[model samples]
Target: MSSNRITTLLVANRGEIARRIIRSARALGIRTVAVYSDPDARSPHVLDADLAVALGGTASADSYLRADKIIDAARRAGADAIHPGYGFLSENAEFAESCRRADILFVGPSPESMRSMGLKDQAKAIARRAGVPVLPDAEITGDDPTAWAAAACEVGFPLLVKATAGGGGKGMRRVDDLDTLVDAVAGARREAASSFGNATVFLERYLDKARHIEIQVFGDAHGSAVHLGERECSVQRRHQKVLEEAPSPVVGPELREKMGATAVSLVRELRYLGAGTVEYLLDDRTGEFFFLEMNTRLQVEHPVTEEVTGLDLVALQLRVAQGQALGIEQADVVPRGHAIEVRLYAEDPARGFLPTPGPLHLLEYPERPGLRYEVGVSAPGEVSAYYDPMMAKIIARADSREEAAAALASALDATRIHGLVTNRSFLAALLRDPDFLSGATCTDFLDHHQNLLDPAPATPTVVHLAAGLAASVSRRRAANPATGFAAPGFRTLAAEMLMSAVWQPVGREPIPVAYRLAAPSGDTELVLDLDGTRHRFDLIDLGADTVRVRYDGVDYPCAVATHRDGSIWINDATSQSGWVPEPRLPDRTVLAASAAGPVSEVPGTVVAVLISEGDTVAAGQKLVVLEAMKMEHPALAGADGVVQKINVSVGQYVDAQTELVTIGAEGEA
Candidate 1:
């Protein structure tokens, strides 16, 4: 039985995935409705849908996760079906069952199938029964402090404490010793509760060096299932996948067949429908693999799969939801070429990938064939703390892995995002890493190859050019052409004199620049002198933000924008950086006696105050842990001293560079 019954489909998610689903549904002649929170009212997903509904909530719990509100919105819009794209209530069994009872089609597996493998522990049990390999794990029970300690002892040291109801590396932590075991479990529980509405967790042996591989499996209303090729998602940080590719370099034809078969067997046992992914952790040393968990929904990296297989997975999902059968056999699904994908996020790679939320003053993405951009952002938009910091996903495909990798690298270079710090340069460096190029990728790739994540240093020439641009922008509103005019907010000087300015880039010392007006005539040109060198440049104004500068015998198209930090950002095709007007005097309040106090590098809430006033702390001792954008960062005391002042407690939200703890010098206090 086959019927394309869906005429109007409502997407209950936001960001890139929502936009992705809407595109696919529209291609099949289905009208799409989008539900958005308050912060996402101006997002691309809202504007992409044929009909938009406001959920009237800034947070996810009140908006997307509210099953009743979503269902009501769907009915109000006269929608025939609903699609939960990956996050929010996508895998909530109760929500799926409610949809079935309401006689509304859900573009996913049946509720029974969702509950079968929704939790990690339950999924492992089912996999074990289906003849798939599984690892030994301890399922944690109710609220006993001693219970957590006992479970950790049983699992041994170097254990992984993960949420049973969560993914995306949100509610997972590692316990290295007895001292941090209790705290790790408690933190994981709190994060799990905040992320998945479930505090249940389990303990398992942590593999330090493992590769993550997943098999894509799809089923229909009829009892039929097939597995697409496997994808390698080993390059990750903090338990979240950063980059992914299909047909892993390490897996040959034989191993690929074996993994696919194992994944399909699980679908046969559960009779799963719609789209799903079976994840496994492969031991790089032994070439053996064990089932990790099964995602009961479409994934964030599905574009890479579509690129290689030449199939529209979202279309298949909609067809299956409409009671369509498997019209093609497994032999018809052959993966050709290679594909790679990278997630572009608004995060500071220099600060441990901390989330940096701000406006997108300038946004330009690569547009070309064989390169797909699944983006859900636009200029003049803010990257809010209310949801994930993902701005877009750039995917590339070619005949070989090297070609695909090179294409993705080129695309990243072509992307330009100003006004907020991002991991763009870090992603480019990763593609060029020697180990990555040699296919020596593992889960700890980022950890072991930390040098690859460092932000590139801006060349001295670029900094000088940026300095000139900054100075010129500050004086853009000059009163007269021939006579030099004073600044509007400042007192006028009797005689026109040369102006001096300074430039300060992050992680480097400040630079001083002396500049004088070149002429009183047509195009304004300035002569800048820095470090005993003089350079002259003529500026051609083009609108307010973008400028065309003729310098060094070439015309450069540069965008000048101000940052949240009161710094000026200058960007071009070859370079992008943030520069601030240098201060004349060094602030003494910013430094401690030993220069080792704990300060927050990112804005976050104090989740744990591990130290108190008057407590003796050693070097490298954890003072507090801050939670921001669903990730935890520990602020450590860098020197031996006593805690003189504790400025933060649990639940106190602080801003970047805010002093959270003050450690007294060893001889004082």
Candidate 2:
């Protein structure tokens, strides 16, 4: 075995994973180089690295997915090794081979090992050979729709058309019947081509009720490998894992050993090297597990396993890449306590979990014991439309699963994220859910509990009042000199003339607040009238961005922030909310503009135009499809109408609220 060490490591990825790899490499005294697209020039990961290289494009195809560009960057940066951080070229066998050709160590398994498990069909076949149980599946070999449908039928009803080249729930579609099978296959192929550069896909029987259990495996050049228990990632949306935990709630020690041994056997058969995860689907009713696929790179949810086992998987990968021996044996491996991780994404749960990329006016995570934050973006930064919408991964560890879940939920509640819609509230709600608490979670967890996807309960009236008062006070403070204050927002005609302002909570109607400030000295009192109702509050203290008030004898402390766009954000002990100040003079032109037809909800590139000008469409019919952050979102017609104009075309980039199709009622023109 060679004794070469990685001195300068180049991370060939972006976002949290890049930052994560840099952290581990830095701790080991390795200089890290970060590669980024044009949009990620100033991203946190790029800034965190010791050196940065620009790939010079906005989209992944033009930047991150360019293997040649990455290889060039590594050579330019004089990197000794390249770490593909769990996406993009992380599982690309050709990229790994390119690294090998360049004589730069790829901190992962062998390229041959990757190819052996890269394709789902091939991997399943290999698993069967290794005595690992696999689900029934059929490979899609041709472009013929009849052949594809025949393969689906062979796999049976309610099957999944999955891309052979990628993970992370991309390039996959579920077809329940023959009618949609062809379209599903076509969509999956397109998505797979876009994401993995491989349009090849296969069919697998869908498991409606199953637990996603993945065994983390590690191997070295010296022919030793061990499994680091399992992580249950059943809490998902659109087949994408949202929450993950270590030591699955359903697996006992015996089952864990059996699964782990089975996973280890497969890796050992391939003589796999570095960090890898062998995923499996454990049937909820049958208590049987089937090999799903093997991710030839570090998994996104590796932190949960790290938290429970106290092992740095990245460090291990680095060591393995250095041709080192597996320092510990299977008998030495032990997992303790429990760890839970939730992916905090810049997305709207109420709106089909669509990605919402925008400025993050305020991004703050509560500091507490047992809480670990792997943040990808920063406040004053924007979630670019070019990459994944995940902002951070929040993990909590405790003595038991219940405590870990509860702590994570509370921490999420305390986290202050503003300026864009997110799934933070939904994640917290799911964590605190009774079924989740009881460990009764499966792949269909979100499907069965659809209520969690709804918008969070409206911000309480008191919170809104506090935000309004805070905004008013801030405005007054800024308007008046520090020494000339006669109490913030105070009027000389005090009681006779109350200050009024209009505040609107997000997704709610405007509310008018008429408030009077009292007590120029101590314990200020606020009298507020809202909707013909009066309420009184005792103002204990007011800081730059926080307010402490006594409403109905209950002390409420709220943290408030105002965006550059005049939007106010408030976070209290229970909930977080955002408010926009109603303009004093509404724009008549905007009010007169038609609010009709289908519009893009997020910024993306139009991938498909399903309707042309003058085409008659029914309600809920997909008129256009936009691809953003590697996910497809269709603009559906709101009502039956004839398309008046097709404003967008394929390959056109658009912003949020950009009209894609202008539809008019029949004979309206």
Candidate 3:
């Protein structure tokens, strides 16, 4: 441990990453402080820190992006350094300079290095100058059609029109032919301008089947740096990575050595300090690689690197920022084992990967070693609409890639998350996909196979019903009391099994579940047979209106609450909260009423509803288009139908469920 390292630190970020940094700092005996916006005052990061100060803003630009507020908060809390997790000011060179001017350590690369690598075009130039391979790109101008065309021709067809200041897959377009180049250029410029305040578009050869690989590089002020191998982040949705793993399935020893050496060379030449990732586009067919861009901050997928390298990246960042040399030599850092990380998001995969924001009614994660979940929300926590929808990063590690994949798969299966819709099942499906398992992936994987990633028609009704039945039986068994019932054996009015059920159907109305139960006698036990599962009930009849039921090796105490309209609401045994009956109506047709339909395919807000009720629309006609998250989804009629209803208007925040128009089959009322 270096004695000169900053003693107290302030994390100028929120959510899981912030909590993660604080945890690392505390383990090193360093006090941690936190700065939060109004929405994140009660966030896990704020709660985990030694001191928390509210920055008092709702939006990112007004809060987290306010460097002055962050500095003030850190100064007031007496924090010696500030850790800009990943986003926000993490890559802001001016912020780093400001911190340096204020004599507060910034736990990242220096301002010079950030400026050198922050610009994509500039970074490519630097890579080229450093004798590193780089994909060719064109100059970006706001109003240069001829230049754009010439650039497109130079880059050839199937090229990418991208915003120079883009991140998170925004302001990007892929043109497969010359005819669409102009429109793509304009669209990319417009989106880029709107997203990052920089509409300047550039051209690059779009490798349709390229593997997204990146190497982790660390540096220090004393001129020492090392590469921590590579991570395969090719599994993406809309250019945003959904899954990442270390020791890329494609990169063997020789390729890893070459990529790692180039990564270290780039950082060392730039005198980079702290933790950073150098992204590359690897030609899977040719085994050639090109420099993508260097992320000048700790990455979201750092856990995979940490798991394989057994290195504390945050700690190293702190030490390096304190002007200590990266003590270990290049040979000291060796990649070991295999690790995989899957991002758990609060998004509805079936509904076009739209954000699902609500209270988390129930959350369960496997707690086994080698399987880690980095999440901020817990049971009763809110998945707010204001922040990113990522719920957690579920990581697993093993001695080999196969074992690691299996571990992650098992961990995902064992996990049970309720309340809000999530991408857990989708991630599991992707991990199990044969192509993904075989390392055949690219940035266009999701675009090519959206149906596979986001399954249509939602989960099957049978599966939901089966899960509901199991939950019901488990709930009932929990309600039984520890002591036996009061009813005597000779009593004429024996105890009756009470079951009040509710049914919640997809795209339909709520229904009631009807079932009969017989109370247990002296010898024979109470049994429940539903959905191919047998349940032996252990009934503990507590006096009054309460009973404890035991099923599936778990005890649940339930209080007989009000029953009406063939519906029963019981106070759950474990949570002490009321559990509504499962909805059972076969077809209530709630999709139209509940405003459930694909609003947009891209990240954008709904601008207008082009269809009206009772209007018969064609299958390919645009119904409603949304704008948010920097993309657009043009809602189209999946099948010819009479327009039944329109749920939203222009300028609504529609991600997945902003139903523009509901279409009913012909002759349907």
Candidate 4:
């Protein structure tokens, strides 16, 4: 067997987490090894590691989750230990045992502890043994439909069918009605089998509106354990955390002490050896919290806790794994201030959060005090579909929650990411939301407050005018590349320069904007003709993809970028606005929102077809259900019509905007 000390560590993970672990390991002067799939050959994590090994295939299952390959890679690199770094195989008890058999150190709890905590059903029983409060749940007996049917009735409506082994919102489905119970069970089973290799599921009563609070607990080989604090992870979409904060807004000292004690009790009972998080669903009305589950590995939102507690958790994990006792006791642990984090994903929010797989042509971040960026990819990289679409985690810290919120919002404004759509604007809006500021956040915060997520209207005279002016400046730079001269819209003398351009927002038609420009008095001025509404503004090109424009007596700081196709994009703190040379194409009439011509917004397998051919349907009736990213989206009938054709079948995966069903007026054929 190898020594307990870790000399070289193999990071069995990818993306932001790999980089995060590498940073801490590097600080300790430890050599780090990285493993990659085919799609991640050029990933930043590979270059940052001292040695990288190809683990074969492109998908996570073929590379990161393959215990044999990872152990082989660690041996090939002559590594002393393996840090699973959160996701793939991080909590897999079998993999931990494999590492032990191969004489390599596993930087986590013992395999027995992982087995006890990996399954929610068994973990709940363990929590009960530790006197931790748990939710009322029923286990499914075998795969019998009758058993599940009986269990469903006992648990009641608005319940969740969760995988006995699950995390990250996968392997779960919400059953709101009895009619949907069977489908939800089947779907959840499929996802559970595919994601965790475990089809065992159970029924848990779902809380309508609750706060997700998790306590960070750490233990060592000596059996001494302590709790850090609580983190609020209620702000979520698609059942995944989008924003998190340390020292929860609502948790007082009394509640914090209680939650922390319960978590520490569990850790000590398990004899856990490293970083772990105990999650609970806190009832907002009653101040009662029930144990949800325990993650036997580090969480994605651990940085927020680190910011407030002022500790490098990954470093601590390494030390504990080396059989060293925790340096500080519970009394030594203290939280300084508030810390907030938001996940930036490569997803198109306007298109139902569809993953946009493409290259990142430009990636710029906000650099300021109290702002920390734990990123995955830099500029000129590809965001593939083989893994999670999360690109970076932006964390901000301050003495007060309001100050932290404002600072993070400002930083988000200064950041620019192009080549693919992201949820940056949605996160910006969240920081500015009044309800969020007032701490009225819960599990369904996004579900109830979707208006805040929507971008401001792209119409009105000023918006169109701003688009035109921004486009003109970008076009000028593209032409000159040296100076602002020699461009079609540039004016050498003080004369009005009439310029017109078309701007097309994605999923919308082209908008033609005409404006006049002049360089009078050595200052650039633009007069936008908004259908006879003359609005004047000053435009200044700040080098390095930034523009400062004065409009309506207010200066707008916009990060601007020119794509390879000559399209201009602009993003600010709260809204993302852009423009491009409108293409001269055939015009088509737009359909009403209730029209049936709208296509699917994301690529997913057709799980259920609710309508039949030649069947009359209401305008809002469900036509088909598609499953993508482990979430279900229903295609509704946009207009009252008879179903003409169902173009997809169950188990068939279809791309975005693919025609799943066709509807026509009765007897039209």
Candidate 5:
């Protein structure tokens, strides 16, 4: 065992994971350094670190993935060790070796161990040798399309073409039939090469109904290892885990013990160290589990395990890296109540979970018991298109799974995030889903339940009234500072004239609101007319962009914020909505410029231009592929037509709503 102590550590990562590691290191009296890309220079994680170094690039390829630059930053910061926090070279065995050659402690497993398990194909072989059950798979050996088809035939239909090098749902494609097998393999290879710098892929049998269970395993240099427990991560979208909970509801004491022992056995066999997760696919039909791949680094969902086990996983990683023995054994491990975690992403669930990268005008989390937030960006901060679009991880722990699920769902509802679209409401809906609450989740949960992606319910009239009042009150207050003590909209004129304004709520038609200030008596009263109906309400300015409206003896406190584009966002007790005031005169030029074409829904770099000028295309044919937040989004033809013009080229950066290809009528010049 080595006696080297890590006094100063550099986190070779950014965002919430980096901040999380810095928090743990600071708690241990160790100073932390942070490395960031150009976009993350002013990020919360960089500000939280004792020292920060800029790598000077916007994309991960030019910045975070530069192992040489990261090591140099560590050396310049005088850091005794480097902590690769989950992505961007975290599982890179070559990077671990580089740290060793530089005499810097890598706060993870050794290079040999990483190499043994970094690739899925190799990891499955090792797990099989260790007597762990594994599914049948065949590696793509040659470029021959026929050979690829043969391998797919051997594995059978309804299989997955998965990248051997990386995890996190990247470089993975599900092919249900032979006709799409080749395209799936090609796409998976391109993605794998882009994500992990490896194009190698393999075909694995896809279980129709499977529970994605993973065991958190840890090992130390002193030949000690332990399994904290298992986490259920079956709920997914595009093969990426959306929610995770500790102590899976489906696994009882006997099953948990069996899986935990298997995980620990693999840990011992590989002599693994630090935080690692052993992923398995439990076939719901047969009640048997098969080895997937082992994540050789800390998982994004590690917080759920930490919540239930009452352990600081980052602290454990640090201690193990310092050559300290894991004092606790398998028997010492005890899991408590249920804990659930959901990844809050800056994406539009209604739009196929497309990445929505933009400024976060307002980000607020409800403060409640048993609720934890591991946030990456601050309000008013930008979610760059160059990186992952995940904004935060919200976790809740309670005595039972039911309680935990309810608490998380409620907390999500109370969260106020504005500016760009997000999957907040979708997550809340999923948590309250009957199947999810009953622990009947599988890898295809989202696929089977697409209704969750539907648009939120229409904003209630009460909410709209509250929002209109709040906005009017704010404007009135700003206009008359000297009359701060006076009632808002209190016109001295005896004639009560109605003020009219049209407000358009998102995903709904325009609403006409006519209001007039009533004669103030004991309290301020505002009279409102909606759809030829009249109502009276007592309005009170609560200050700080908040207003309280009393209707039917109930007080509703509404928080209001305005976007730069003049959109008004209001959050009331029951719901939140964004309303844009309709201009008395609409811009005809802008409306006329909007034409039918294939446009990008989010900002991204054009990776492939599949169509050219005058090219005839069918409806739903892919015309251009845009890469944003490291994921490819294909812009498809809207109807059968000839491509009138191709406006974008490969590697060109485009913004949301930017037309990539304009399709005209068939035979049109």
Candidate 6:
């Protein structure tokens, strides 16, 4: 490594990946330039870089994907080279060519090689020519239904209609019969047109139980290239990978060698330079493999490969792009141990992987050995809806696959993220699953064991306790007059005040939990007497309605409330307050009436008002249908009431217990 050769490098990306590349460059005493969009002007990546330049707009197309803007930023920042750290413009061959034209080195494969390998169909053709086994398929053009259907039948009934320009599962469809081939192809083409602006599609045999395996390959300008190892990326959802591990579960020394050799041969035949990945689908039952696709740039799951290989792929990319020869031979790149990386995303798996965007009030990871964390943001940072929802990458390494699984499980268990929802626990569940541990997973692993991936009992008890403790700390802070007058000023005369607090955890239920807390005066201990169980809390003053509390020797994340009514919510900790509301049963009364009046029992949006005004209705008959929280519930007639007047209409939003229609007794009906 020479100073003059690699003094300055520009990272043409943002978020965690950009920061990650900058870290590798800085480790080698290389200055790093960060490029950011308008929204990311104050982002962590921009702040961490030695120099930063604005890329103008917030959208990917206007910022990171704009080759001219990126090149100009690099030139202005005095960067000698640009590293497209995965995603955005990383796989764009034209961008690489533009960088070369500007006399700014691009830290990746040559443009011509990238162009050859970036297209899935083109890459498959190249693989076949290089003696690599490829999936049976034919590239299709034009909208002629008959020709396309004939092509589909030739590939077989159970085949894939894939968009030539598609990735990330978009524009991919599985057709099982000739009757549905036209529709599948049309839909795939439309989606491809929208997502990648390329409607031209191709056909391929779809393997039901295929395991996604990819070989990590590196090349240099000196006609030298070597394969590092393989990564298992079978754990996926909607065709996007959720969890990845190196030294694939099904691949041993023999399979690894075969796959690695094929990957090296494919790259050399294409004259590829810099780092790339050659993905394959391995049939678990038959041990047969076929070329899937080629990623012309670094992948999101590269951390897993790095963990097992102990090599910095980014550094190698920079060196190779500068005309350096491959330093190590294939025999020297033996992968040792097993490594697993779980992508902690700001999305809720329970809600169909819906993005969960909010502020990161608290972010903490364990300092345990063998666990490596790559985070892009810190506490109080926000995960907006404008970008990919990945919060962090939690990687763990161990001597064996079993050790690695256990290590990852422990790491996830120790991870705590508050304020914003994350898939931390969900990822932990996958790592701890028996099938995942035994390497008995396929593309349908999550679909097969949906219950395991999404536990529906709400937050874990430990997390609840932690949030409660944090809330308790906030209560203590508001209790003191000096801290804040938010809490009722310490009343020396009153022993305890009757009060109740409502807490809505995960924005679902409002639990009417009442607690009796003792006043604090240094000697008096704050105890939370809930449901006859006593829990002690140690509150540390942090000034102004903000206190850090330790329950069971663990600090909890908490916040304070401005008003009374017991509405203060602590994230994952137990808290104590001076409010004790006695529980009393509601008074039951029997009303004697001659006629019945119509009323809605529960309030919800009216999906359909089954009965109109003057419509006859029988007793206990269905009157209206209401939809609440995406679930439908029916409202029935009580005591043979008539639809005297329709108060609500279909598709009208109503409150709880709102009257939908008026009803009378049987005689009136």
| RMSD of each candidate relative to the true structure | 4.9, 3.0, 6.8, 4.2, 3.4, 10.0
Clashing pairs in 1: none
The numbered model that scores best in TM-score is 2
- List ranges where model 1 is wrong by over 4 Å: 1-4, 142-150, 153-157, 457-499, 506-567, 582-626, 634-669
Give the distance in Å from residue 254's predicted Cα in candidate 1 to where it truly belongs: 0.7
| Model 2 per-residue lDDT tens digits across residues 409-437 | 99988898888888998999998889999
Estimate the TM-score for candidate 3: 0.78
In candidate 3, which residue ranges exceed 4 Å CA deviation? 1-4, 144-147, 178-183, 446-502, 505-669
Q: What would the per-residue lDDT of candidate 6 be over residues 484-584, giving only the tens digit for each residue? A: 55432233434554335544444232335444333456422244544555566555553334545456776654444322333332333322111112213
- Residue 472 Cα positional deviation in candidate 6, in Å, after optimal superposition: 4.8
After TM-score superposition, what is the CA distance of residue 559 in candidate 2 from its true location, in Å? 2.4
Candidate-wise lDDT, in order: 0.81, 0.86, 0.72, 0.82, 0.86, 0.72
User: Candidate 4, which segments miss by more than 4 Å at Cα?
Assistant: 141-149, 457-501, 506-509, 514-548, 557-559, 571-575, 583-669
Candidates' TM-scores?
0.86, 0.93, 0.78, 0.87, 0.91, 0.75
lDDT of 6 at 592: 11
> Model 4, clash count?
1
Give the 10-residue window scoring lowest on summed lDDT in candidate 3.
Answer: 483-492
* Candidate 2 residue runs with Cα over 4 Å from true position: 1-3, 141-147, 454-461, 477-484, 489-501, 507-536, 542-544, 583-593
Q: Write model 1 residue lDDT over 347-454, tens digit each, in one string.
A: 877767778877786788778778999887888778887678889999989999998888888788778787678888789888877899889998989988878777
User: What lDDT would candidate 2 get against the real structure?
Assistant: 0.86
> Each model's number of backbone clashes?
0, 0, 37, 1, 0, 19
Worst 10 residues of 4 by lDDT: 586-595
